[model samples]
Every structure is written in C-alpha cells, then in structure tokens.
Target: MDLDQSVIGLTSNEYVFEVERRHVGQFAAAIGDDHPLYTDEEYANQSAYAGLIVPPTFPIAMNDGKTEMPLALDQRRMLHGEQEFLYYKPIRIGDRLRCQIKVSDLYDKEGKSGKMQFLKLDTEMKDETGELVCISRMNIVYRSLAN
Candidate 1:
C-alpha cells in the first residue's frame, strides 16, 4: 500500500487482559527466566510489587493481534523494525489491563535498497483504575519489492 498519512492517528479497539499466575509463570518459563518473582507466589508476595509479577517482556505475549491496525497493509512488504517499551507500573498477576494501539507516525526514508515507509505504532496499556501501566512502541518498515 502507498504511504497513507491519514492512518497515522488511527487507533484500534481497546482490549482488556487479565493477568493470571499461570500465564505469567508460563511466559517466564518460555523465556528461560527462573526468577522467583515470576513463579514463586511466596517469594513474590514479599517483594516490593507485593505479588506475583510478570517478566519485563511479558506484555509481548499479551498482544495476540487483538490490537491490529485499522488499515491493512501487505504483510509481504512489511518488516519488523524496532520495539521499545516504557513501564509506568509493574505488571502483576490479577491486574486487569486495558490496551489500545494507535498509529503514531507514518513517514518515508531512503534506504540502501529503496524508499522505505516507516510505520510507528504505540500500544498504551492502562490498569483497571485508569492508571497508565505501560506503552510499547513498534516500528515497521514497508519496502517496495521493485527495489
């Protein structure tokens, strides 16, 4: 698809995710993290977070295509670029998080291969109390095959 500036501000529907002990432990295990905070309820209960917590990258698992882009782009031409996460609060078990994805920016740049369109998407997650939990920024590059 051509670079569409209008898609910059487009946002996806909000998705709510409930953090579960099983899910957190599984995610931690999948990543080979044996930290007690992620799996040991007794140990985690005494930590500063006061309960079982998820690994730093656990939010990636929470995103199951629930917040897809409002517009469709050719997957063949899309390339995953960079991802950044900013945490405002710790993600703990039993916390309900409401998340929505927004297209924050759309721009084009000249690459060694060809002109590339960059799509920046931001996922903002808030707790049930409407407090900011975290924000994940993802960058995608769309390159023309003709290049």
Candidate 2:
C-alpha cells in the first residue's frame, strides 16, 4: 500500500554460487544468444577469455532466491519495473560468486492508474577473490489492489 522508508538500506542474506559451463551454455541458449564465447567451449578456449564466459544477464540465475525485501509486500501486486547491470569483469565458469541484495531506495508517486510504490534493490556480485564481478539494480512497482 505505502512505501516503507524504514526498509531502505536493508540488506538481505548472502548467496554463494559456483558457476558451471553447462549452466552458462544453457542460459545463453535460453536467451537466444548464439555467440561462440558462451556456447562453444573450444572457441572460448582459444579466444581471449580462455574459458567459457557467461552472458551479461546470467547473474540473474545466481541471485535467484538469494535476495528479498525486508517488508511484507504483496507478491501478487508487485511488478518488475526495470533492471540494470554493471560489470567490472566477465564471469567465467568455475568461479564462485557471492551475491547480496540491498534495498537502495523506496518512494511513492501518484500515477495515471493509481498510487504506485517503487522499491529499488541492488544486488552486488563478487568473486571468491573479493573482486566485484557485477552489480544489478532492480526496480519493482507495487500497485494498490484497489487500482
């Protein structure tokens, strides 16, 4: 119903995932990306990456069930508004990644449809070497059921 400012800056539980070549290939295929870097191990092994590299948005799978808001928001009324990713380095197979979700911001506005609450979340992914691999920013819109 209303934006909960108290939940801003709240951090969720950390999740660790071990990237595998099969998963990377599957994700690339699911996204309709036919790049050799992602689908061809022999090609990737000869390229600059020297190994299988995951797609840019592949981190979504790694963060699955890893993050959550600190509030009790209605899941049925929530909409995925936007998503962005910033990568410091490429994610390769065999790397262990750690991801954590943080509630970055929360706000409410009156829209043509109705009053909408926006929740911004940031998920940081880092490798086992303590280097940042990527940062994903996701915005979710919570619409009042009455609207």
Candidate 3:
C-alpha cells in the first residue's frame, strides 16, 4: 500500500472572509435551529448572551467553496467520520470571525474493505481582536476503490 501525506495549514491572514448576521441566519435556517439566539437580536438579548449567537456547528458547516482551505481528500470517496469542537469564547452577532485550516494528521489503514486513508484536519478560529474562539477537529475517511 502506498501512503501519501500532505499538510494544509492556513493562517487568518491568508483567508480573507467574514461571517455576517445574514450568513448566520441562513445557516440557522438550513440546520432547522430557528432559535432566537441565532435569528432575532431583540429576542437574543433576553438570553444569556447579550446579542444573537451563531450555531456551535456553524464553523464546520461551511460549503466547500473557493474560500475553503484546499484539501487532498479524494472527493469521490470522502466521508465525514467525526467532528469535535472546543469553544473558548462566545460567537455573537456582528462579530467577525476567521478560521485557518490545516492537515493535522494523515495515514492509511489496511481495512477489510480496502486501504482506507484518514485525513485529520485541525481548524483554529479566532475573532477580530486575535482572540481564540474555537478549535474544530474534522476527520475525513477515504477508501480506495480497489479491494
């Protein structure tokens, strides 16, 4: 079995994008979590957070657009295995956030089906003020076609 590895790291300076209230709203709608914290400002104020907040999983739910950090995952055989998030600060409405993703680990396993490769990604998110917000770990499993 041949194991090819790659590291994909990006800093906040490299990724020039912002997540606004509208984006948060759309994400909330798509996830079916129509909570006030994710939609209405007025309603959000009544909660623990002073303003509207984005969903916890919003950071990892981004569609694979050009803005996304490039990955070597074989898209055809890629599968979302697991995800874990660690939040240090609150992500509120009107707060701009940036994330840099990189390959944390890569390896191939000789599974019964075939040679399955695991690509582990670590995404660090921060606020405008250079404060760490959350760190998300994503695992993608790729199984080769040959048995």
Candidate 4:
C-alpha cells in the first residue's frame, strides 16, 4: 500500500487543551510515576516550578485524538515506529496549550514481509503566552494490506 505523498507538509487544525490537576494526577497514576512533581502539589510548590507539574510524557494525552492524518489509516496494520520529544518548559496545571500536528514526511520501503509505508508526524505545542513548550515527533509504520 502506498501512502498519499500529498499529505506531507499538511497541518491539522490547532487544538487547545487546558491542563488540569486531574489530568496530571491521572496520567501520573496511569504511568505508575509517583514523583513529587507529578503527585504532590505542596512538594512541587516548594520547588522551582512553584506548583504541580505534569510528567514529561503527559503531552501524549493532550492531543485527544485531534491530531490526525489527512488520509485514512488502518489501525490493524499500523505500528508505532518511534516517538521523540523535546521540552522547553515545564507544563504546569492550569496552563492553556495550543497544539497542532504536521505531516513532516512520508515514504515507502521494502520489508521482509512486503512493502511498508512510513508516516512521520510532528506535533508542536505552545503555552498561552505563545512560547513553545514541547515538540513531539511520532513515526507510524503501515504494513501492506492483506489480500
């Protein structure tokens, strides 16, 4: 299966998410991270951040299915190729974030099983002040459609 090359450079609509305490606590609990910054508000307030802060990986949940490819995708044949994140500032509770995803690259390659399609997505997030907070790059691999 071949991916639509035209989708490269396309960007999805901006998504706005307001960080909340519950969101932070739930994600921390779900990931089994009991760090003070993620769970203890008082401890975090005494630290440099001055309040509750989310775990580094918490942005994964901020998209809320809003980050989508312009073309259709088959979940059964899709695989997580890789994920990379760069954080500029700590995400704290009550911070409003503006986010968007862009299709950075797409290509096909020959695999042992067959041909595979690769889609690279870059998600950029900024704070209410318009300062960049984090950038996440995810690569999705699609196996050839079954006969």
Candidate 5:
C-alpha cells in the first residue's frame, strides 16, 4: 500500500454554512417534499413545530461555506465510499448558522484493482447560540494507478 498524501487535519478551505429560507424552499421543491412541515407555516405550527421546517436531508441542500477541497489527490479514480449525517437540533428557516469542517486520516492503499486513496471529512454546523445543528461525515475513495 502506498500513501498518496500526508495531510494532517482540516485545511484552510474548511468552513461552515447557514441555511436560508429561499435555499430551503428550493431544496424542498427539488426533492419533491411538499409536506406541511416543509411548506405551509400554519400547518407546521399545528403540527407542533415552531415554524417552517426543512426536510431531514435539508442540511445538504445548500452549498453553504464548504469549499476549497484539497486537489492533491488523483481525480481519475475518485469515488464516494460512504456518507452519513447526524443532527443535533432541528433545522429551522431563518436560523443563521456557523460551520466547521476538517479533513482527517489521509492515506492510500494498493489493491488488485488499482491504487486507492482513503479520506475522511468531518463537517460541523452550529446555530447562532453555539448549539450544534448538524454534522456530516464523508468518506471518499480515490482510485488511480500511481506511476
């Protein structure tokens, strides 16, 4: 197994994101979720929700502040190995949020198929009150034939 990179932790491009009403609405529409909890405020209020709520997967709908991924890895054999999301609080509209993102465990391996890069990314999103709203983890596997 060969290691492609030695990145230690979160890089300079890691960042947070805030969800807005417009972005939530667009995401809801794109995902075909029109439930009262995601759309109509009155209906949401009657359903025990404080206000308009985005779908459970709404956290990823917006581009947010996440950017500047490390380009050191080979892209020809890139693949998403796994993904998971954990929510600490219910995401509501008009809530300004801050996010922290970091990269962890950068390594590589050589298998019968080819060369593969193993990477783990952690993203944390918090509300203005400093309460964690959501955290998403992404595992990416990159396949490339090293020279």
Candidate 6:
C-alpha cells in the first residue's frame, strides 16, 4: 500500500462503545492493576469519582472494527512506533463513549532498517453527554521491502 497517498487525512466512521463494570475490571486485571478505583465497586463509590473507573489504557478495548484507515498496509510489515493518550476526564462505568478516528499524518523517511513510512492516527473520544473525554495518538511504521 502506498500509505503516503492513500491514508493521510483519512477520517474514519464514528464508533460507539459502552463502558461496563466487567470490562473495566477485566482490563485492569489483564494489565496486572489491582487498583480499587477500577476493581472494587464499593471502594470506588466511596471515592471522589463516585463509581468504578476504567484504567488509563482501557481505550484499547474500544477498537471494535469501526474505525479503520483505508491504507491497506500489510500487518506483517507494520511496526507500532508509539502511542499516547490525553485524558480530559475519567472514563466511568456505564458511560457510553464515541470515537472519531482520523489519519492525521503520513510520511516516509530513512532509518536504520532503511526506508520507512510513518503513519500517525488520532482518535477523539467523547462521553455520552458529548463532552470530550480523551484523545489517543498512534504512530505506526511500515518498513519498505525494497530497502
């Protein structure tokens, strides 16, 4: 796939996800986090948040095949470069979230592994009330086979 010409500025369809208590607990446990804010309902209710909260990386589970770039890049040749999340508010249980994903940037450069294409994607997540909750930035590198 010619990512530079095909993916940059591509905006994907919006996806909606429901945040359930079980999902929060499962994600926390999978990441080896036993924080009471995420695992214990009673403890969370007593805290400032007033309810169970999802972990910082809980957005990973929100990828339900609704937001996808049209690059058609090969998965085997793609490498995850970096990922960052900016949180404006905590993701609480029972909150329905919506995400709008976009391919913000795409470029090619030469690196130790030779020619590489960098694809930057951004996903904006909002709560059911339409309040911004978080933004996730993901960078992926596609190595050139001809290099």
Per-residue lDDT of model 4, residues 1-147, tens digit only: 467788898888888988888878888888899999877778998998887778888888887675565567778888998998888888888888999888889998989988888988888899988999998988999888778
Better of 2 and 3 by lDDT: 2
Candidate 2 — number of clashing residue pairs? Answer: 0
Candidate 5 residues lying further than 4 Å off, grouped into runs, are 1-5, 13-16, 46-50, 107-110
Candidate lDDT (C-alpha), each:
0.85, 0.83, 0.71, 0.85, 0.70, 0.81
Clashing pairs in 3: none
TM-score each candidate: 0.89, 0.85, 0.76, 0.85, 0.75, 0.84
Model 5 lDDT tens row, 87-120? 8877887776676566766776776876567887
lDDT of 2 at 38: 81
> For candidate 4, what is the lDDT?
0.85
Query: Could you tell me the TM-score of candidate 4?
Result: 0.85
Report the number of the highest-TM-score candidate. Answer: 1
Candidate 5 lands at a TM-score of 0.75
What would the C-alpha RMSD of candidate 4 be, to one decimal place? Answer: 2.2
* CA-only RMSD, every prediction: 1.8, 2.3, 3.1, 2.2, 3.2, 2.3
Q: Report clash pairs, candidate 4.
A: none
Q: For residues 100-119, write the lDDT of model 1, one tens digit per residue.
A: 88899999898898778999
Give the candidate order by descending lDDT: 1, 4, 2, 6, 3, 5
